[model samples]
Target: MEATPGASVATAIRLISRDKAAAASSTCGPGLASPPWAFDGAALPQYGPGASAADPAPAATPRQGALPSEYLEASDEELEARISAAKSGLGDRVVILGHFYQRDEVVRHADFVGDSFQLAQAAASRPEAEAIVFCGVHFMAETADLLSGPEQAVLLPNLAAGCSMADMADIDSVEECWEQLEAVFRGRETAGAAPVIPVTYMNSSAALKAFCGRHGGIVCTSSNAAAVLAWAFERGQRVLFFPDQHLGRNTAKAMGIPLEAMPMWNPRLPLGGNTEEQLRHSRVLLWNGFCSVHKRFTTDQITAARQQFPGVRVIVHPECPMPVVDAADESGSTDYIRKAIEAAEPGSTFAVGTEINMVRRLAAAHPEHTIFCLDPVICPCSTMYRIHPGYLAWVLEGLVRGEQHNRITVPDDVAAPARTALERMLAVRP
Candidate 1:
């Protein structure tokens, strides 16, 4: 299966850099609580009172990126050669971390392939690795660098790669919403009312995580949202979840919270555009956030597919709006999407709502089933689409030449407390 036609490398890189700059320059004063460049370093909260584990000393090795096309079109043998060269050149000094959503070609080269949190942990574990090559998006690399020691560098093979949903809840917007909420809740300690506990999804910035940490809250991934929500409800009467309303609503609804109990908080509105009574009565303030890519999927699309192909089952990501989710047969993470399709009976038809690349890849992987994106026009996470193969080649070769191009580094000051928040989430066992 072909990847949705990617933009030219220069165009893609320029677009991403522009967005990053815009994000950086934006005022983080209101509605958002994180800096565009926010990151958490190693000075994490010591979970134990004494004798916390020390990070291992970084191991030095040769430079990385000996081949250019190996990242894109290399054959299995050529790919092995590239990996062998990178390993032989860098030894323990380099660790390649891949996200679950990455292409198999990229995952094949990963020293570790897991979810976001898992990838960050892998980066931290490799104290000997001087350089970490991240095969995901900008946020993933930032998280890795935050988790890894300062001496270690986190390199993104394609700097253009980013998560669109992550960009939606900018720091300014979040901070502004918080202030509005704070104003509403002031001295209103009435019984049966919900107080605020901000719950951010893992697909957010370190600054957002820091905001959570500072405000006595925690972060959560899709798999652990239920557990995290349970934790939040224990601490406060009302919970504020950002960037992904679908996840927040789905998780809370599953926990027996009525739809009416979860009110959408529009950050664009004055006072979150929610009345005090609405805010006070609500158990969860679901942000008016969504994944543009996932939101494109609709009940109509699913119905059309089912009619076109009898016995078709619809599956979608939790980032999708609640209506689409309600219309689908199942919903889950990217891994879950792949697994559901893989495990489905042969000759089954599946309409998936998510990024187009992964959906197309799944279709190619399962020849026995009819797999299609819920959006027939072929929609992708435009930001993630920014990481074209050209940039990958350029970065890889640059690494080989010891010329670092796009290195995501989280400073010590921010990392210290940010790691505390991240560690808190990590410690919340399933």
Candidate 2:
């Protein structure tokens, strides 16, 4: 059974299993335990030591069976009831943090709904809560674990909910890039200026953040990227921004840095495929990475939105490509997008270039404003959408039964330095 386009790996597996079971029942033969589509190709890289983003291990069969059958077969009402009961039972012991990109099903159950940085701060504020259930991606769970108290357990409902862009810049690849940059700028540092200061986005792995902290670097979110870049320049001659080239380029460009000064670093290429002159003249060394969801927004979509709705204010996330950002009327973080719509006059039109779930929610929330996604094609953050209602029910039920499932714990060495970087970012004012 071929997977459908835009369908998640888990959804595809479930569909295949349902079809096979139905066919077997009619044929009067035993159903296959696993789907025929399961094949070993490459295993997903784990977030730990010696994990390589470039070289993938052999893939194992899909793990849809790992989810409890009861949860999968349960009706919406049943699942909702179970989740509500579990939340009520846990009460102050647990805090659920959901990102803006999460589906409405999961978002409705969250104690706090905000962007990644806001969610992390929310987790930190709730020290009394013993468990922090992060209804976001793997990196977010790790961040919550880092920010929350040591006694607090951070749980991610689905372990497969990983960020593709975050995986693009592994620790090893980034360290290699740093080594090459050091060689390039060996004798360039003078009395007042250092070579380059590293800055990792909040979407990156904990190891990358630790790398930044150890090297006198800081972590940045979309909300404070410009200010963070300004801080970096105060101490270093140049900045090595990573894991999302689009964000780095867009932020630097907004700061009046020339396009020629922001050179992209492709991990596959030697010295990031740039000449020595280009490296020396570069102000922001952007890693060649991007959000798969945001990258789907094209300038054509923006044009169509404007054509359809006259006076539509186009807003986009910085993770979008430079062309899309340039085409949009305004661009900022998810929180900024929400606030912009809130501040708009009644009956204002907004064409948002971000995840579809958030756009739809915003549209529903503010009926007065004509809010719509730039891309007509449905495109959600696939990894984030992996956290289905069934998974949420399963995890919540487990917690009710005194069991901790899918708890995300960062190593002490990694967490310590990562926390330092996070602290620096928290201290920075926009």
Candidate 3:
């Protein structure tokens, strides 16, 4: 959905800086970065080979406080003990949510497993769940805390679990863009009232959600962007969608919003490259952001596959840029990408855009179709790489011993308003 107008851009910038600072302080990795139009090997590290199932897991550092010495070691037997202990103390009061990209072992323990949006809904619906042990990334845990009741505590097994794409759309950059847009919009308006709305993807932070709520905006997931955008348009004449520009562009374009009407807001630009006239005339102001992993996919890759294998249907995630999506036969969520390929007839070749790990997993699952990642180079979701099972046992063991580790609590102030934005999206019929 589109962003609501008059969300104070300056406030959003301060929020972004504070978020970056807080992330730097944590043991976990920084959150995801936005998607880029092109990849340069110099800035980004080469995607490493997938860690072997037989590879020794990272050993957990024992927490300084409580729990017995043997329990701290967290051997298979110790994990079994922790499982029994957790069952005894929490006893179905704790709900663990796992994302699809998470390792099999971690997924095995999740009481509810799905995409980020689904996980949030699952956490919010469980009134009896006193603690949500989110086995995804930091943002996912934060989402759970925001959605869950105040009495319930959300925990991230690994605080380091983060998404690289989410990191790209800093709150500071969003606020800066908004400030520039506001000035341009207000100066030109004969009427003093603002016309732009602020919309954020569900991948963003709770504070971002609060920003939307405070400014009369709404949150959206990939599955419901069209409906959300329709909601935003009903609220305002134009939208300033943050973080996921591709999602914004793709969704709006789907709604018949012309590409020229949806100019990107670049914080790096001196004045966001928009004339006062442009801001006023614009229907959608897409933030200059993207998913790093998905951006690795290229049009050249699609062309090469089509030439090499006739009738190869290309499927991709919407996180890829408009060009890549256009080149592909279809684009949607990771699940959607998988379903499209699975539905293809035998002897059909398929190219996919998303994390390499998932693509590889899908390739193995469906030997009938030739499934390959759109990017020739292997790229894992850098942030998701942190969610190894070793981290899982460490956090679970702490909970079993009545010790809180990596508790992700959204302050009441943030949660209160953030809930409003989220509720708006959740309330949508789609």
Which tens-of-lDDT digit does each residue in 1-430 have in candidate 1?
Answer: 1223332222222344345444234311121221111211113221110001121111221112223433445544565565556556766767888775554445556788777878988999999987888877777887888888878889886543556567667777889998888888887654744478888888887778778878778888887888888887877888999879989998888789998888898877886776878877899888876666666678899889888987788888887778888888888888688888888889888888876657766776688988877876533344433333334445555667787777887666656666777777787876
TM-score of each: 0.75, 0.87, 0.77
Model 3 ranges off by over 4 Å: 1-91, 187-194, 341-349, 364-370
Give the clashing residue pairs of candidate 2, or none: 41-59, 42-58, 42-59, 43-57, 43-58, 43-59
Please identify which of the two predictions, 1 or 3, would achieve the higher TM-score against the true structure: 3
- How well does candidate 1 score on lDDT at residue 121? 87
CA lDDT, every prediction? 0.68, 0.81, 0.68
Error of 1 at 14 (Å): 20
- As a TM-score, model 3 comes out at 0.77
**Best candidate, lDDT:** 2
Residue 189, model 1: lDDT of: 54
Model 1: residue 49 alpha-carbon error in angstroms: 50
Comparison by lDDT, 1 against 2, better one: 2
TM-score result, candidate 2: 0.87
